[model samples]
Target: MIRRWIAVAVALSLVGCGEDPPASPGRFGEVTSAVVLVNPVINQGSTTSVATGGERSGVEFQAEDLTVATDSTGMALVEDLPTGTVTLDFDPGTYSFQVVREKELYDVVLAYRDGTVQPLFPPVRYPLGGEVVEVEPGESIAEAAASDDTIVLLKEGTYPGNLELRAEGVLIFGAWSPTRGPLSVIEGNVTVLGGGNRMRGVKVTGRLTSNANTFSAAFSDIASATITGNGVTLLRNRFTAGQATVPSSNAVLVDNTGIP
Candidate 1:
């Protein structure tokens, strides 16, 4: 409900004025705060530049440093912020997200209530080694995949949006290497329409589906999977919330956690 109102107010501000104010999350309170969610489907660990109003008549203002936390939901929160418009400046790079595999980071803002704000950030993946294309911040994942064959070096950054794998035999490997690389979170649901794809070292917070496609994965974290593809092997991956929803298929699952 609070988020809805905030959205409404932002919208009205946008409508009233020709453009957004220089500083946004505009129109936020003395107690105004925010919750940032990384859409794991699109990010490596994300960092935001934060500014807030001062304690006095909303005239004085100060910048606040944000702290990242990895709770059960792995969300971050800011509290006791002054009621003032806030704007986030995103810097693209790798971050030590404290997860097995690095996930991409996406930032979201909401009304700061009595200190209960939650948002999810996300996007990654894999092979021994292959032809590589290193991605940058706010680039197109699908475009990179479509052009680059064999492997994609998804360096620490946020993709513009979700990804759909159209190339067969392409291995989407997140980060620079296994031992190295920051958080790589995908922001949207993913589907591999082609076959013989491989992945590792990426965190996806949305549903994953493979239709009649065969793929292999390891060290990847998936929210959920619906695999109709045969000859699939999932090894040492993390599945949150539930297990893979598969019908009849030759699927191999080994050392996967969080499946009931």
Candidate 2:
């Protein structure tokens, strides 16, 4: 019985001394990060050029509360991210990308990613002679009206200075600019197509059409044309009635109220 016990003890010690099998590598957890790249195309009226590669401007990455990340080679590293679908926010632009991992590269082509990530530079839409020009927010419809070759199709938004439709054809306004700041003032025959457009400190000297919509102007003066809209305000300007028609919802005041 003693000899048997000794043998059993020796066997147990040898088992303990044997090296344990190597641990399996841990599974790669879900990791992701948001990345934004700049668009390369430059508009006709734009004064600056678009950036590319590492020199691209307006590129950014946002994950949770952090907005910065590192881009090495062709891949951007968003380390230690939880496993899930990650979104990348960028400016109103286009980009081409390649994912690089362990010396392997994968091409990534994205058309557009919409989010709160505002573009550093505003996008502009130049008229191709007679094409319909949609003025987006943060965009400007400058020199289009002055061009004798192009017919300016103005959308809903505030414009800077007095808009002049010097040509013979019709020039439409009310297209919304992205910024929607007070600098958007109209000085031409602006047709209000939709509601909820804010026009502050604007001076109109041409025909104004409501088109079953509302227009808000802090201070405006109507001269030699008809004003047809619901909400038209003449807060501080003099209205020399030529063919001015005020709609029910349109309000025409004679003093500065507040920011619209």
| Best model per lDDT | 1
Model 2 stretches astray by more than 4 angstroms: 1-139, 142-187, 224-234, 248-260
Q: What TM-score does each of the candidates earn? A: 0.46, 0.26
For residues 7-100, what per-residue lDDT tens digits would candidate 2 score against the true structure? 1132233246472211111101112222232332321222232232233333465544456433331223333333333344444332322222
| lDDT at residue 150 of model 2 (Cα atoms) | 31
Tens-digit per-residue lDDT, 130-206, candidate 1 = 33444555676676667324555454555544678888877665542234322466777888888887665666778
Give the range where candidate 1 is weakest over 10 consecutive residues by summed lDDT.
Answer: 53-62
lDDT of 1 at 235: 46
Q: Candidates' lDDT values, in order?
A: 0.45, 0.33
Error of 1 at 152 (Å): 0.3
